[model samples]
Target: MRESILKRVAVSRNVLTMLVALWLMLTMNLPFWRSVWQGVGGMSNDSPLFLLSLPLFVWIWLYVLLSLLAWGRLTKPVLGGLVLVSAGASYFMNCYGIVIDYNMLTNMLQTDVAEATELLNGRLLLWLLLLGVLPALLISRMPTRPLTWRRELAGKLGSMAVLLGVFAVLVMSQYQPYASLIRNHREVRLMLVPSNVVGAVHGYLKRELAAPAVLEVVGADAHRISAVSTQHRPRVTLLVVGETARAANFSLNGYARPTNPELAKRDVINYPQASSCGTATAVSVPCMFQDLGRADYKDSMAGNREGMLDVLQRAGVDVLWRDNNSGCKGACDRVPNEDVSHLNLAQFCADGECHDEALLHNLQAYLDGLTRDTVVVLHMKGSHGPAYYKRYPAAFERFTPVCKEVQLDRCDTASIVNAYDNSLLYTDHVLAATIDLLRSNAARLDTAMLYMSDHGESLGEHGMYLHGVPYAMAPSEQTHVPMVLWFSDGMQRSSGISADCLRQQAGQPVSQDNLFHSVIGLMGVRTSVYQPQLDIFRGCMPATVAQQVERSELRVD
Candidate 1:
């Protein structure tokens, strides 16, 4: 009986392997193969995460190939069921990748994957193909054995229970705090799974989960401001929201570049002393746009606040948002938002995927047709790191010896800096082009552009590769960012502003908190909350002595 059971177990293993192979051949999509290929070659010409997990990539393909041929000898029904289940699981994972627009195959193109290639002569794609052979060999050598009905029944029951449990946990964990790791780190699913699964269970049991709250406008309202406006037609204010731009590296703020050459040429207001309220888009974006400053972001449900969009819309300003970043995270849910990511010129080289330039294409179109006083928000995928090489075109490869690998720490600081600078170079082009557009339109109406980043990044500084660190200990490079306001001649006249005075005050400290009210104030809106005392337009007369000091400290130059 013991010998018979041993033979039967061996047969089961071979059958399982064969089934997985057949299923992959049938269910794996073209994108999957393309990703596998890109993963091995350090080419982000397509996806993002390909290089980060190159080693494990081949193993997945190998598992599939080997499971198909020799494994078919196992009892037909049981093997067929397992194949179907595994196929579904793998397909689901791939779909999740698409939802987040993260492709593991190209993840390392910006940092260390290419450098490592020189040392290992091994391609992740090639290795993955080789790995597939191992399972094929295993199944071919195993002897076929008779199946036991009772054993088969037990296995099916166990698999069903596990699948149901996984599904239930995923649903229950959605609104809870512990599962934030899953929501935020979906790209690193394999590494994150076991712990996330454990966290999910705990998250399900925790009953105190808080539902997201709707914020209310209070204290300072912009509605009355527009109704009682002073001497001007409202300004056409365009706030360009930047993603993942760090202050330490910007040449305009003194990082050693001609990156800000264009902005410096114009009579722009450079708020070199500005800081982001949070470290990640998930936190900082909503916090910055809403009435809640960094201090009050945690309990955002008090309903004592309003977002920048709400305030502008309330004042009867025509508001529109063009997003090139990952979906708006509900920040622009209340406004007219357009996904112009596909129009990005870079997409031609980016394998049809979009980036920052996509937002710029339709921008002039949107500006040209607006009949009313308008406020447009442009969100850019600016300097979002870990894959900087893929963000720009080869023409901007001026900073060479740039790291093309994703493991940023493995490369020298100079190489990492080079890659980042290249991305910044492209940003410079986008900004210059945008300025030119606004300048041309300013002749017809008052126009201004305000650009601010969500948060900064850490590139191997103290051994961190990305942003999202807690705020209190975040490095200056991660919080201090380049903030600038570019005003047209018409805007200056309408707002009754002098370029020389604004430039003199440009280096002063300004928090994004002032932005919500400043927009309304600049547009000549007269809400009770529109505090000119906090407005940069007020020039040197800050609301409080402490705010004045804070602004002064920010002006290091």
Candidate 2:
């Protein structure tokens, strides 16, 4: 009796799929339509014909595309996934002001469970329940005509031909304006729902499914060289990988706020103009550790072979990675790495997550025991948002009326910035503490700390809330990162790096591109891959010291 009733209410397969697509297009894509409305010169009598026809033309194309895919038994599952993914993309886009693109999608995929959990707030749940789960369930429950593959294929092809003709007519109606909008605002393409998701997945798969690349080792012939090499004293350096820390927020970089009160007092060399290789951790972390700048970097490249860490390790440097953020993004695959969050230290950790200061646990002991040219990579959970309030402890919450809520959209811009700044305060504390630790051990070892953020964050800037917009359209807030260098007296004298010269070069443009070669130059690692010109410290080092940093080919053997 139930089957009979379901059959009576059942629609043809194409009808059900097209209806679901229409429902998703109408409801699940508010952000995409808003971008479209703004793009078409919203609410003005400006080119009334083209403005009106453009959105409809886009609609027709989306409908045609979705409908064509909804032909058979696969329709319900595919449409359901589209509905859920579109809802997810919509929630992020509409609430956080992020666009779904290949990089953003890759970022999402790479996010750890702890990181993903923070994003699961009431509003996101509501979005998923109202728009994603309910609709996906409805799509699944809706009865469709039984599949007759051969006949269905024939009917779909015939219907597709007619749809294409109508689509062609719509396109020709406003060809110039449509072409202009598309060409001028290419970012609009990334704002579209489901299509944007589809295109991102396609782009990801295209790279992922390609022929397997044989691992190519980088900096294989690396060997250390220093004018003042010590058999007893070791070069102890801290490579601090900051998370989502923008240069504009750091007072050391001349932000209006005194967020870096501790760092300011420390007399660190602050590079105000240092930008990131990418706007997200997934891309930036690995790219910064490689010779490849943003232009040539790919996520796959990180996994293809050894990176800077391996090179440093190969050159008899005691390399260690301590993580409070997500794992080292494959940069520490071959290094002795441990996660602070896993230790769950009582004061510094909570709920399987740790404060940035947790990374410093037992660090003095580690340095106390270090006997070789040592490098420790501290991956910090610095200022990663919308859960900015959670990054620091109560003492670090110097900013009042801060947004305690994880869902950032609920808070005012001031609250968001306040919470964000507090996290930076804590980061400042962490860096200062690390520097202090390094300074304490300076007598035993040539100690220095080099802190560079993987990427920057957007805090309600130009309607963008978080980072990971497609790089081409990302603003300075998402790309401009903070880089700080603090070397103890021993390191400064031993390495021949003048603080005055470093301060002068700090104002000049520096980037993560310099990181790969800069570390090489700093440790006096001689390698074919080391380019002295790419090292920021090269100018600060004496010509005699800098001359030794040149690529082996450029050197007189």
Candidate 3:
């Protein structure tokens, strides 16, 4: 009995090793194989030799990867983890045409539990079970192989040398073709499994673990101007930061659909030529509030500096950030911030998620308590997708047969657009409600509202289903965002600017760069850091009034 048991144990261990090797060599490379096959199929009248060389190159690459993974006692566990992660990454890339890069991994790290849970679906579960869980189970059940330390060390060294040799020969044989292919089709390299995942994780770790620089305080000389009478009502400016709202879909920007009926009714100034600072909220949210423009913007530098909100607070203006989507991406770290996503309001929230309207709940009480000049920022969960249909209530679903699945590929293109348009409609309603709220408070405060989205979305355009592509390579559908402004009569008089003047400036090219200086100019804050050239309000204010304010700098003497 003992002899039989030993033989059975040896057989199971060998079987497990073979299974792991097959998974590493084939299962993890499924996406790469498919991409290669598709590329070859699209080739028109290509040489037979070139086609034959491609598969040979891929085989050598896989052999190197498999050899490197097949050493040491803990090899099974490490290979198992890689297999699972590769499977998950492959599914997302194949289904969504998304590249797993450092920015994407960073976005994943920043995702909240609620946002992460939305990605869970029956199809994902099925794939995980087939490709991940089964392999992991086999690995766990396999008995450990007993080997001497010397033998294991020697085996690892031998495998490393073999892989290096194979890689060197492959590079030498087809250096020119390989270089040209990688240079022209860079995205194809990003589709390679295990390498992309490992590189992305390494890059993310390097960024997160790097030593942070000293926080540079901007607008230290900031002080409110005294040109106006002391009895003038304090300003109440509401900065509505929208999510994933593309300008191409807004009727105010010449879309065929009337997506902005409510804002249209109001005499709002819609900037049709507006653009976003970045293509993802992870980058754009912080960039929008930073003093640096897009050309000089660096994510690491932005994280170590005081933003526009800090400058407003330093100037004795009250600043509040109420978030309905994910948190403020550290932009609100130094200010008073609220997360209203967990509120149990049945009218606005369901299944642990809430519409943008939830941010408006109890907002009046919060505003009434503030006596100083206030800058209130409401971060709305506007049109954030693959679950666009979940963003609004049933009443707002005017478009029929909307996509209800988080996996957008499963739905038809029309259904996807219908669902996205419905989300935009909801966003319109939310913005209109905010305008009404500001109008209601016009009697007591000089009220104004500014709305702009963090970034745009891509609904099945060019095989792309969502945003977060690198900005240089991103499409206009992911960069051109909607920006609208509404000013009450009280606000117009207090700021010494007219709606007509703002309308004229609306046609000029503007971006998130204008936001920092424009807000400070509107609030009448005098500081050396304020650049009049970048201020959109500078062109809109009366020439004499603008000259008087420009000369009325608060001297510290």
Candidate 4:
């Protein structure tokens, strides 16, 4: 009886460990498997052998890494934690089509509870239970094999070395094919299960904690130029930093739908060719307000440096940031900022979320208290999704049969687009209403509104649901953002910038790089850090008598 019991216990321990290992290998990599399966058709055209062998190699690589990291007695607990994280990562990647990288993980850490709750749903809970909780429970309950520390360490090292040798041999044998595959499909590397997660977390921590304490400040000598008040009207310019609005959907940008009907009716210059500095708000918002262009802009640099708002404030320009989404991602930390997202506005707010129009509440009263050279930034919650239907008021539900659920995959492609477009329609209404608010104060204030989204969103295009894919691999849907400029007649006269000249330059290729200088130019803030070459409006403004004549001819009567 004793012998039989000992054998049964040994069998049970082996079986449990095997099960745990298998679970980790499969559950942590569902997204990767899905990607490979989907790309099978395309794989035949490229390197079929490499594609076929890639999965096995990845599985072995992951198994070896996990085994080496979590061996003997400590295996169960460590593996449990990894199981949860990997499962969660896989679920997000599979559902939202997001790549989990250092920047993305950093963004995840910074996400407020309110924002994180928006992504929670039955589908997510189900995935967590099946993949994370189930595996974790099994891992915790499993009895690990007892071995001497020396033996366990030796086994782990030997196993790791063997795995490394195998991997190296495989790479060497299929060097050309594997190299080509990886080079062409760089995104494939991002889907490497728990390895990607491990690397990303480590990278995030190192950057977050080990960076230099002091940062270089740009535009320290920023002062408003005398050209700011030629007509003596307070140069009040409202920069509406929109969220997740793409140029492809804007009516003014020649979309089939009249999404921008209200803005289109106004004398707004729609720059269809405008691009974003970064693919995510966390990166784009700060980069847009920085003197550094996209090529030079780094998250670490942006975090430590004085931004456009800082420079503007230093230059004696009254800078106020009114936020409706995620607290301006720390861009408005130094300046006077307001969080109107929680206001109990009966018209546009519900269920802890307010529409973009909520931003305009008490605006006239707020503007009344501003300085003569004021720049009020309305950071809008425009078109933020996967709950696109929730972004707009019920009246603005022009696109019917919208995707009401957060689980985007549950909805059809058409429904998703409909919901997104409805949000854009509401955004249009809010922007027009903003213009009207500026128009109300047009007599006293030289109002001009610059509306540009921080980053574009992906709506079920190429099996991708939301934005925040790496910038290099990101599609135009995630990069080509809509930028519209509406200048009041007072603004045109005071700034001596012809409306026609600005309109003629609307089609030019511009980006978030132009924002810092263009605003400085518009407000007439004379900053040494301001780059004229980066400003979109610099070349467009009238320079000579001949140019002024051409500008007048191109001006709308």
Candidate 5:
């Protein structure tokens, strides 16, 4: 009997081990496995200098383990219970005000679907199948181990203590490596985990998590512009926001494609070297348009009395926001805003759904066919998202061999770029069309169209696919964006902007912040609060006294 028992015990151990191995193998064949592997490697690479930070990693893992152990006691099935809880929490956060876009999901997955598929097609699947089958078979043959209530109780108490300890440390930790931990917290509100923990982790590797260099500014009275501009009437300016537009990808900026064919011919002043404030719309949009600089964005939002929109409105300009984005944040609160997302405006085109055109369709109607000296803001859903092909119509699909879908990594780099370029091509057409619309009323209107992208995107460079990394650590492909301004003929003549001179300064480095002053100046509005030193129009002053505006850097987290 003793000999038989020994053999049975040995068999049981072997069988359980085999079962675990098999499950692991099966998981490896799935996309989720690839995501885990890739994410671990990517996170590790981001902080290679701190690769040996064992103590830190151990602390985190231990904390998680302890929490799981405690939960196990309270719940019969603790491990599964914890995972379910986490998933529910994530869903709740997304369902609420916190936006969980594709970037967040993709980043978490690590390995893209393409890589996972490729691995499945190779030897990975075979090994996983063997492991998955062997483990279950062995586990089935083994006898169940009886559970001791006393021992389970002890484990639960011990785990709880450990979990609490870790929580204390996290709260005490200042200058944490990842701001994502904090940023994400805003959305998820996990008891301890921050929404931006991902970004915070990357911050340990790169110092780009701060604000952009351009907005490193402090308090300024709104009435400061009277000294610079003579005109006293309140000047109205409209800021046209472009989404996912890359400078190098636009034809106006010399992209090989004819993306901006119309804008290029219209003599719009394109700023070639303009960099974005952040990599994603969530980070960049708020930061760029916010009153505070990147470094102190949170503080600025809390402490500063007003944002760009607020400041302009305070100066008596009619600030109107027309958006085609999924939703508008508080950025448009001070002004009247219209949500154009629900409008069905694609009458001429059938292939592409209503996007940027949605915001434009009712513009004339919104204006009541009567021109108002109003500052109208048009936020375009231009080139937005994983499905590039879906953003544009077939007519604008001029660039062939394009990646119509978001599984960009599966396609060759050139083809993926071609698809993106085609989207840009569509963007160019919309912009050109907008210009023409404005020009048609130029005789009675002092209209100006200023186009600036929230951030740039990475096609497949450096083994990365999309945007949303901290800007400083991000590739130049993600930072450099295109900015072009279409000044109505009347405004141009009023500002005394020579056609030859304006063209000469086309390639200059002008930060988005400069628009704050230039717009007010061009409108001949004499606010006492505007800064002349940071204005680009100052650069265009008489060449004798013309001074180059200082290039400011933005901190991105």
Candidate 6:
């Protein structure tokens, strides 16, 4: 065995790298090639020459890139790293049908240990073992032919120039058709192995490691509209920011399943047409809190600006963020916040991550002790896959044959849906419990609760199993999120916004863009940044109530 292993074939570095690139094209880029095949008429087109040459064009492009990195001393190490990254990226892209982009990279970077552990299942292990580790081991054993320094440099450049010239000729042969193909199917390029991941890393490092932006305080001039009025009691509002809860699976949003049985009976006003700011937590959570709407949102600029939390806190509302998901993605950086992950709570602990119950555990006591107006933001790990079974307790698994595995693609489609729906059932219980707590406190404090998911998820839809697809190419399963609102009788009277009025306007479109302005108006905050047109609550307000709010605003002036 040792003699056989030592008898490895010897090749020059450029020749070895070319073979490695070819291996990558065959093993780790089926999805990329598949996209190309589907786009160019898939072998049925009459022009066999154009169809065949187009793929060679891409192969030469990749070969030229790999050749640049195949240099002395670091060639094997860099190539080994490339194998590992491509194996992992291809495994996910092929299995989950997800595209690697800047935002997806941000999710991977921000993902905690528990979330990362959930992905270490049998399929991924088999893939890494067969493709990543074995290739790396063989790369380590390969013997390179000896050459003088001058000869090596000259040969490398000469070979690279020839390949570049060939690549250029191929592109110019079918320039317009190839250009149109790329323009029509943008996701095809994003599916490329290793290169997509490399580009994403470059973008992430460029943005995150840049000089930190200076924080600019906004809505400093904000004040309560009825600060001087003594008629109403102090308000208590609960904003539950949910994770990966798609609208298509929620019973409140017309899902065929009874996922929201508890919430369905609570008379909550469900926004059927609600959408998210982004397709991942890292982007959606921050964008949800910032005043800038999704279209106007830029991460670099968002870091420097104060969000709605700052504006609400400036208006004298006692703001606190309780996170049961990953830390607020910088949305709660300025406010008082606590992480509820890995809590020792006996009823809702598993897989090194706690359930949504952690956010609600002893939450009433905190609300009961509120001396003044308060806003508590509960960040829930609702239906966050591919560990949907772990998001809820066993009793909530009303759907039989539920998928308990983390690798959602391995499970059948029915089992996957059952597991995800079970999570929604548990979330419904949490939300209903919150409403009950607010109802119990209705005598002294007028209370309300608003639950909006940061983004949605895809469960075996169009061969996709998880979230974080690019927004432009994302399916409705990843962008259409559930938005639920419940107000107590006291809150309705005090805020002059009733459940009936909310139900009437529930059919209108609502999104995270309206969250900032809606909350500002809901809390009776008078600020320069408040846009009444974007406030969903304002449009639903009665004419008499509008007049009353207008008079109350007159007092602020």
Highest lDDT: give the candidate number: 6
- What overall lDDT, based on C-alpha atoms, would model 5 receive against the true structure? 0.54
For residues 275-321, write the lDDT of model 4, one tens digit per residue: 99988888899899988889988777656777888888877788889
Runs with alpha carbons beyond 4 Å of true place in candidate 6: 1-8, 227-232, 301-303, 542-557
| Model 6, residue 93: C-alpha shift (Å) | 1.3
How many backbone overlaps does candidate 3 show? 0
Prediction 1 global C-alpha lDDT: 0.58
State the TM-score for model 4.
Answer: 0.92
Candidate 6 lDDT for residue 379: 96
**Candidate 5's residue-wise lDDT over 1-557, tens digit each?**
96578565643222232233233323322322233335345455565533334234334443444243433233323323333333332332321112233343333334334222322322333433344334334444445333476654465455556655755555445224434433532322211222223233344324333424444322233432322233322223456888887787886677766778878787788888887766666556656665334554542232223456666555445568887664444466556898766555556333323567666775766554443245777877777645677667778777778775544556787877877887787788888888877776665555678888878877777656666654445677777888888777666554555545666877777665565566655543333456676456655655532221122121111
Give the alpha carbon lDDT tens digit for every residue of 1-557 in model 1: 97777676665544354345444444443334444443334453332443333333333433433333222334344334434433333332332222111112112122233222432323333333343334335444545554565665455445445544654554454324224433553333332211222243343334114534445654344543322233244458888888788877777788777666666777676778889976667556666676546676642332234566777776667888887766555568778988765554644325544656676775677777776677888888788766677777788878879988665645788888888888887877777778888888765668888888888877776545666544655677778877878888777665556667878877778776777667766654555555567677756323453243223321100
Q: Which ten residues in a row have the lowest lDDT in candidate 2?
A: 548-557
Q: lDDT of each prediction vs. the true structure? A: 0.58, 0.83, 0.80, 0.80, 0.54, 0.85
Quality of model 4 by C-alpha lDDT: 0.80
Q: TM-scores of the models, in the given order?
A: 0.61, 0.95, 0.90, 0.92, 0.65, 0.94
Candidate 4 ranges beyond 4 A from true positions: 1-21, 37-52, 71-73, 229-231, 544-557
Of the two candidates 3 and 6, the one with more favorable lDDT, higher being better, is 6
Prediction-by-prediction clash tally: 30, 0, 0, 0, 46, 0
Candidate 1 or 5, higher TM-score?
5
State the local distance difference test value for candidate 2.
0.83
| Prediction 5 TM-score vs. true | 0.65
Tens-digit lDDT track of model 6 for 415-450 = 989888999999999999889888998789888999
| lDDT score for residue 502 of model 6 | 84
Residue pairs with backbone atoms closer than 3 Å in model 3 (clashes):
none
Report the error of model 1 at residue 381, Å: 0.6
Off by over 4 Å in 2: 1-9, 211-213, 226-232, 547-557
